[model samples]
Target: MSGGGSWRFECKFCNTKYVGAHNRVVSHLLKDGGKGVKVCPKVTPQQLANMSKLLNDCKERVKNAAPKSVPLPSSLRNAATSSLDYDMSFTCSNPTSSEVGLKKRKGMGTALEKAFQNNSKEQCDGEIARMFYIGGLSFNLARNPHYRRSYVRASNIPGYVLPGYNALRTTLLQKERKNIELHLQPIKDSWKAKGVSICSDGWSDPQRRPIINLIVANTNGPMMLRAVNSQGEVKSGEMIAELIIECIKEVGHENVVQIITDNASNCVKAGALISAKYHVIFWTPCVVHTLNLVVKNICAPSLQTRNNDDVYDACKWIRPLADDVSLIKNFIMNHGMRLVMFTEHCNLKLLTVASTRFASTLVMFKSLRK
Candidate 1:
């Protein structure tokens, strides 16, 4: 209709005009919503089917004639999210070794793909969420320096190949360990002048084994010395003392100022033995442990009996009031609707009291008050 020589033909069905390319004219008549042009309202099911086949055939002819325009294989396109071997990376670019990211040219997409192209942030967030869900990783991991650093490094490196599993455990592990040790050398060296404290803590493993960890601390910071497994044996003074003595010897007895431990009877006995062995290295109770014990006594007094010796005996109302607060906390937290309402009125989160944590009752009280 636009030109005289069979060019720019008009759709007979919908009266929509287009240049006589079979794809545009047929697709316009087919009422396909994905195409940019308005769909033909008059298109029938039979006409749509025929036009779709014709469009596909036209695409096939164009693709056959233009092989260079075809996208890279799916394997290459998906390389963005997969692990890459280090050998595949270019040494010349000196890109940090990291997770693989796609390196193919970004170009035009279908109408639907283009519609979602601007949602790259959401897509990245979804992938991160999926990873956390699949691995059961802690949400706090997002706050870790290494977690953000890894993403930063990955973004800079395209088509990065991840190190092999064996390399990760053996070669790369040793390399990283050495690198960390090098950085810690100055801190370790400060032990000679600042006089590091040798602190020990005991934890029960899943198998009910007693694991004692020794930490060396100074003005510089703390570092893990080692962990000793008590193998279901009693955590007696002799056994625990032996581990602390070994650590002291390893660290050099002259460099150690004080031995810190929890107020457990066994740990107290161990500290006593260590003090007797080295007069210069005194024994001190862990401050946090002492604070936790004090909080427990004040907030959750014993109910078996009350006498003049009991601290809460004079303040008879403290125990029942504490129990009532605990009940209220549980009531609100256990019900979703109550919790939502509480959040709406007060932004403060309800913190459950924990025996191991210092001042947990005080923290819960503060939250409730706020």
Candidate 2:
């Protein structure tokens, strides 16, 4: 205890002495001590009562010393004392013509008024139509009740008219065709003398229907010429040659400088025939396909070492490694459980298989090595 009747306390945990307040000493013992210091866990009932009395006295002193607020004026006091409830009906002195029109139009209700004021329906319809076109939505999408409800919800503007499916389809299709033609006209005109290269590829669709796609490339850009279904006909060298000739004729033979195709046997024969038929225009196999073939041959196990020399036998060593890689890839891809485990454990996606390209195998191996 200190002089002049002041109380002094010392923390048992840290030997820290505090004067005039046991609370400070308690707080210090609890919070500010080092790891070695053990806190004093006991508090007597008398000490707790003394702390509570001290807190109450401090609060009373603060309340007594605080400055009092000035009394409000009679008018302000009356306003503040008024009840919250008020009459809804009121008189307007000089409302404008627009305000009068709005009041008259208010009979239609607030929801309709807001919708008509914003005109969001037409804007939303245009955007939705654009989204449908860009995403290639099916015609049957409009038949869905959910879709119709969504459309109605979005098109809440007054005087908004929704187009029928047939009308929308006809209008949008014609617009798209006209837009494409307008864009292609300048390109065609620019390439009139320079001529375009025709790149063609054949592939089978999901239903096993063979489709031949032709793209004409010039300085402007590459534009699709056509996609022809050749499923029923024999896909022979002669048939492919005839197809190429027909495409060339349609594109104007004088405007086509070169033709490109994959190096398949039929395609090779077709190119030869095309060159023979049109001496002015050149025909060549796709360079990418040729390089892919070269890589395939280099990596093939059939490449035998002629002499036991390391230089010539390098491929012989690579062949087994490639075969092992292919085996590993097949093990991971063919088994669903293993595939999931591989993805989870390795944190990587396996390379997608592309049967037609040898480069794909090389890429897969490289990814696996990484």
> How many clashes show up in model 1?
4
TM-score of each candidate structure, all chains considered together: 0.58, 0.55
The candidate maximizing TM-score is: 1
- Candidate 1 structure quality by residue, lDDT tens digits, 131-210: 79778999999999999998889879999776778999999999999999999899988988988899999887898787
State residue 123's C-alpha deviation in candidate 1, in Å: 9.3
Model 2 — which ten-residue stretch has the worst lDDT? 70-79
lDDT score of residue 361 within candidate 2: 68
Give the per-residue lDDT of model 2 (tens digit) for 279-359. 988887899889987777666645354554574576666667777887898898999999888888896677754768668
Q: What does the lDDT read for residue 149 in candidate 1?
A: 95
The ten-residue window of minimal lDDT in model 1 covers 69-78
Name the regions of candidate 2 deviating beyond 4 angstroms: 1-158, 301-312, 334-337
In candidate 1, stretches whose alpha carbon ends up further than 4 angstroms from where it belongs are 1-133, 137-160, 204-210, 229-231, 300-314, 334-346
Clashes of 2: 0
lDDT, each prediction: 0.76, 0.71
**TM-score of candidate 1 versus the correct structure, residues matched by position:** 0.58
